[model samples]
Target chain A: MYNKIGPIFKKEFSSYFNSSIAYVFIVLFIFIPNLMFFYFFGGIFKEEMATMRRFFQMMPYVFIIFIPGLTMGSWAKEKNEGTIEMLFTFPISQWKVIAGKFFAAWALVGIAVGSTLFIPILTQLTMGDFDWGQIFTQYVGAMLMAATYIAITFFMSSLTMELIDSFLLSSSILLLLTLCGYITSAYVMIFPDWLGWLKVILNEISLSTHFNNFSKGVIHTKDVVYYLGLAMLFFYFNMKSLESRKWS
Target chain B: MISVKNLVKSYGHGKPAVKGVTFTIGKGEIVGLLGPNGAGKSTIMKIITGFLNPSEGEVLVDGLNTIDNPIEIKSKIGYLPEKSPMYQDMIVYEYLKFISEIRGISNEKADDAIQSMIKLVALEKVASKRISELSNGYKKRVGLASAMIHDPEILILDEPTAGLDPNQIIMFRKILRKLSEKKTIILSTHVLSEIEAMCEKVIIINNGEKVADNSIQELMKTYDKEQFIDFVVEGESLLSIEDEISQIKGAWKIEFEKKEGKNQFRFKALISEGSDFEKNLKSNSNNWKLVSSEIKKANLEEIFLKLTSQGEDNV
Candidate 1:
């Protein structure tokens, strides 16, 4: 099993570097976020807050779009090019291929996230006192959130043969999930006397609500489980999509 | 080396793509799977290669069932799909090396295997070029090289010569003939001459049913019983030739086509077993100008047409 997964992972991971798009994506992901943190209209300098709280707050929304673009061609390209037939006929299980692809995409996200270490270092250079613990917890949360988004994109990629469709589907799904938390928050403020328990359920399903826990420097066990569980759910669905081709 | 037993495959609610079709191919045999469009030739090859599952029944490669031991079965088979799909961005050598690694060739041997495959498939000229940069024939050679990189026991090629020039097709046939010396090959082609050139045995399927399966010679001999003689004659009225030929016993049918001159004609006579048409034609040489004559041997195309037409008539 290691023999099979190793080669698949190696090939998949290297394929990202074979094309110029991956480098362009990584550059944009790092460049845009850092540029926004430093020089947006009424940006970090105007906020007067030395912490990266605003950076963490807006990242989940940024990831909703970025992750889909990063993963749109994962399975969709393979299906469109008809290489999925070649992949399935190889001497490896379907799940291994999915796992290998997941790790390759996740590793790219890891590199993108890792490149943002400069932001924290710059924050430390300017501000004498910064909370390292909070930043560490926030990075952990951001990586977990990215995993969930990548998994959703992987699942979406498997559902169709076109890259644009996969991108649209995943972007819409992430948008709807993000909107759930905002809608439920507004609902609670307007009708406090009615259906208080419903707000709790909405927050339970909303990714932003869970990510908010990590940004606040409170590492809740339930929030950790929620992010991991969502990632697993999409991973399971992606495997199912790969397996369904035999019947389809 | 391969066995397909009562294979029945259907796409959702549609009719079965392959309906209870069964055949066994032995080692070192180049067998051609002949069929019209949508005749389940690709479907059967996919099932045998473990790319698609059969709705009912099973395929076995070297006694391992495809349903149960798919990866094991896949490891022994090399398949070039109908489209010859590939990663267009990858260089020819890199793509072959990738496939070699997937087949679990060790680091030391992978390079050797890939190099030999490039040489065998005649891909050295474009080895460093990206797959998208090559023409259709070169891309097909790359696909074939990748399929055989692992040195699989069985090679299943679906329309290996779909799009190629005449010279390329001839070169492909030569490669297939050489490959078949050591490997069992199952090829599907619409070009009947390709089958006649490369295949010793054939399994013809139509409408998801096995219409004919036998040695090429045996199938031709069985389905092509009538002997046809083409003769050129002058001073024979083309209109009265059929009447004159029908008068001879065992002369089943005759057709006449006008030649260049006014009185010259070309006649094809279908004769039965008891007909001594050669002697009779010479004896009646005075009646017409017997310019040149030769017996027409039945080919695979005629047998395929006869079997498929008979199948249509029955249906």
Candidate 2:
């Protein structure tokens, strides 16, 4: 299985380098939020503490767009180009192909997230008070969050034939997952005590709500399981979408 | 090497794309699947290649069931789908190299296989060029090379020459003929001449069902028992030819199909059972001139048209 999957993984991974899209995505992913955090009014770097709180705070929103852009064409492009049938008929199983493509995309995301390391490194050098443990957990949470987003986008990509449709659908779902908790929390504060239970449920379901635990250096078992569980759910759905495509 | 038993396939809950089609292709046989568009030719090929599962029945490749051992079956077969599925971003060499590796060719052997395939498909000139930069014919050659790179025992090609120039078609046919020596090849096309040029046995499908499956000579001989005569008479119309022609002893059926000219009528009818109505027609003509008389044996093209059209009329 590794013999077959290795080539698929290598091919898909290198395909990102064949064009400027991957580079452009990595550059944008690293710079855009940093630009917002360092240069925007009321930025985080203005403080002397060098905490990554504000950077981690903005990640959920940044990943809503970043992960979808990276994964929108994972399967949609294959279907659009009519290569999916060729890939499916190969000696390898569908799960292997799906896993290979997923890992390839995630590796690019890992690189993008890894590129931001200079930010924390520079913070430690200049301020000498960077929270090492919090920063490590934050990066872990970011990678997991990226995985969850990639899984959802990959699933969405398998469901549609158009790249734009996959991009829109996956980004929309990511947006809801990240922002709905905050929206419901604010509404719960405004409403009476009777609807406080609704807020609890929404917060429980919200991805950002659990992601915030890791961002704060709290390695809660439930939060880790929640993100990983959601990722697997979406991954399974992606496989199902591909399997159903044969009938379609 | 491939056997499909009562294969039936449907998309979702829609009408069956392939319905109760059964045929077996032996090793080293170059079989042509001739069909009209939407005739389930691609569906059958996909099922045999283990890309798509049949709704009912089963397909076996070299005695292994497609569903039970898809990877095993797939490993033994090289499939070229209807659309030449290619990665436009990758160079021709890179694409074939990827296929070779995925097919489990070792690193050392993969290079040799890729080199031979590139040479075999005449892709050496454009080896380094991206597939997007190549023309349609070259892309098809790339697809063909990818399919053959694995060097499997079976090859299932779905309309492999759908979009090739005359020269490219000739080159592809030569390649297929060379590859058929040890490989079981099932080629699908609507072009009767392609079947005639490449295939030893032909399987004709119409509207998702098998219409005819036999060797080319046997198919021709089966329908060759009856002959068609194109007889035209000038100077008067044979308005009552159906009535008068039937009395010519062995005349099977007569119908004046078209008006050839102002005073001429052309009739096409089957002459079966040792019918010799031509002499009777000439002897009975009052004023009309027997301008031309010709016998027409049903060729493969006519048979394909007849079977497919018959399929449509039934629907």
* Top DockQ model: 2
Worst 10 residues of 2 chain A by lDDT: A41-50
Residue-level lDDT tens digits of model 1 in B1-315:
788999999988888999999999999999999988788899999899998889999988888999899989999989999889998888888888889888999989999999998888898899999899999999999989989999999999999999999999989988998898899999998778878888999999888899999998888778567566678777656656545554544444555655747777787666544568866776664455567777875466655754554323211
What are the clash counts of all predictions, listed in order? 0, 0
lDDT at B196, model 1 = 86
**Candidate 2, after superposition: displacement of residue B201 in Å?**
0.8
**lDDT (tens digit, per residue) of candidate 2 on A116-191:** 8998898788777778899999989988888888889999999888989999999999898888777885665565
Each model's C-alpha lDDT? 0.84, 0.85
**Alpha-carbon error at B236 in model 1, in Å?**
23
TM-score of 2: 0.90
Error of 1 at B136 (Å): 1.0
Least lDDT summed over 10 consecutive residues: which range in candidate 1 chain A? A41-50
The DockQ values of the predictions, listed in order, are 0.59, 0.71
Model 1 ranges off by over 4 Å: A41-43, A190-193, B226-297, B310-315
lDDT of 1 by residue, A1-248 (tens): 77888777877888888887679778988988877777774455677766777788778888988889989989999999999989999999888898888888888888988888888788779864778899899999999898898888999999989999999999999988887787887666754757777777777888788898788777999989988999999999999888778876
